[model samples]
Target: MIFKAIFSGFGGQGVLMMGTSLAHGAMSNGYHVTFLPSYGAEIRGGTANCTVAIADEEIASPVASEPDYLVVMNAPSLFSFQNKVAAKGVIFLNSSIISERSSRSDVQAYAVPCGDIAQDLGNTRVANIIMMGAFIKKSGIVTPDIYLKSLESIMGGRKKGVAEINRKAFAAGFDYVKD
Candidate 1:
């Protein structure tokens, strides 16, 4: 079974990092994965998005015309990609910034206050990581341990305390969605 997901938001929101982390986690879990990123001309404020495909078998393409999961960190991303989600797909929206909900009834939508959670954590930069934690918990595509390990690998070179704060942020997001 192939699972495709699209993560979108403003460039500074770490959209590509979210997709890349998921892809890395999936790959580390012995799944075949692909990561494709797109961005506008502007470096920080422009639109940025990425598609990640994970499967037991090799993937044929990196593109996801109709993704199984859509994660939107901003309002514009929700409007731009909501219709592209396949029927019965899942959508995770950052309700902290986007007040509007998905109009589609066929899909399951989750509202996570990622920005607010990160702000409460004293680092708004980890908003993407918070969203990622929620997505992983809900989707069960990859274990949180593996995802954190992948995240640590990706951010290992960063300054001290970054990983700890990200872990806390992930835990908060994961806890926000009850099973």
Candidate 2:
């Protein structure tokens, strides 16, 4: 199966991080993976998006004009790429920023307040991991453990006390669906 996903939001929202972690997880699973990131000149305060595709066979294009899954972290992220999803695709929104709900009827949309969830867990910055946890369960691209490993690699050891909080945040988000 070819799985294409897009992560979009303001730069600090960790959209690109989600794509990178997902790509690494898929690569660890021995699947062909491609990660493409798009950013504007404004950077951190500007728009950013990344496309991650995992396939059993050699992947085709890295550009995902129509993605199977979308992880949006902000209102602009939703408005910018909501129409880019495929007919049967799913859009996962960070409900903390988007409350009105998407009106697209052709695709399945889910609103997860990952930022709020992370804050409730005592770390507002681990929102990305929270979103990833929810995404893995919803998309089935990789297990939460693999995703956590990928996240560990991405966070590395230099980013202060991030890894532990991120792990906790991911666990919280993962458990949210079950509880």
Candidate 3:
């Protein structure tokens, strides 16, 4: 099985980190994965995005012109990448800051209030993690336990309380989406 995903948002929204985490989780799950990150000139507010490809076998390339999944953390990201999603693909959007919905009808779109959820969790920086939780739940690319373990491993050596808040944020997002 093969899965390709694109994560996009403003530079400071942790878009690349989200893709990196997903790639790491998939790799730990024994999948061949590739992560490609891109950003505008400005670091903080400029546009940022990444593509992650996961498969059971070797992947030929990292670029995804049309991905099976797309996660947009902002309205501009939605507008920028919505058309690039493959038909019947899945889209996870941040509804807290994005007022509009995807115009495409060929794909499934999920509205997640990542910003509001993160704010409620007392850490706006974890908005990406919140989105990642929801995406992992819906996609089922990797088990939650495996994903969390990979996340903890990647985030090791951070300040205290970081893992706890991230766990809460991930759970909040995972619970937000229904089966």
Candidate 4:
């Protein structure tokens, strides 16, 4: 089965990183993966988005016309993309920044306080990773083990303590999903 997910937030919110890491993790899981990061002129604090697609076969498009999953880290991103989610899709919203909620009944929606969770975890920067965990665990798009490996590789060779916190964020997110 093919899985398509869209992640959106302000530029500095690690949207691109999340998409890339998801793609990498999916690839590690023996799936063909593609990631496309969207751009905005204002950069920091400006809108940003990324599309990640994973499939056992070749992917038709990197941009998701109808995503199986939508992770919205802010209100505007939610407003812009909520309508594009497939009827039976899963939407994971960042409750800390998204004041608006989807009215669609067909899609499975979960608003996780990722930002708040990250804050409690001592670093709000890892909020996107937290949401990624929820996305993976709930959607089953990629295994948490693969996700953690990808995350470690993404962190590069330096930066002590970051990997641990990020791993915790991912674990928290993964564990939060309703089984």
Task: Work out the TM-score per prediction.
Answer: 0.97, 0.93, 0.97, 0.95
Angstrom error of the Cα, residue 51, model 2: value is 0.4
Residue pairs clashing, model 4: none
Query: Which digits, one per residue and each the tens of the lDDT, describe model 1 over residues 1-179?
Result: 99999999987899999999999999999999999998446665767899999999989999999999999999999999999999999999999999999999999999999999999999999999999989999999999999999999998799879889989999999999888
What ordering of candidates by lDDT runs from best to worst?
A: 1, 3, 4, 2
On residues 1-179, what C-alpha lDDT tens digit does candidate 2 reach at each position? Answer: 89899998887877888899999999988999999999546745888889999999999899898899998898888888888899989998889878766778999887888878988888787888888887888888888888888878877876657777887887776766652
How many angstroms is residue 131 displaced in model 4 relative to the true structure, after the best TM-score fit? 0.8
Measured with C-alpha atoms, the lDDT of residue 103 in candidate 3 is 100
- Cα error, candidate 1, residue 178 (Å): 1.6
State how far residue 6 of model 2 sits from its true place (Å).
Answer: 0.6
lDDT of 4 by residue, 1-179 (tens): 88888988888888889899989988888999999988546656788999999999999888899999998888999999999999999889999877778988999999999989999999989998999889888877777888889889878885879889988999888877778
* Backbone Cα, N, C clashes tallied per candidate: 0, 0, 0, 0
Off by over 4 Å in 4: none
The lDDT, on a scale of 0 to 1, for candidate 3 is: 0.93
* Candidate 3 local lDDT, 1-179, one digit each (tens): 78999999988899898998899999999999999988446656778999999999999999998899999998999999999999999999999999999999999999999999999988899999999899999999999999988889999899869888988999999999999
lDDT of 4: 0.88
Q: What is each predicted model's overall lDDT from 0 to 1?
A: 0.94, 0.85, 0.93, 0.88
Better of 1 and 4 by TM-score: 1
Scanning candidate 4 in windows of ten residues, the lowest lDDT window is 37-46
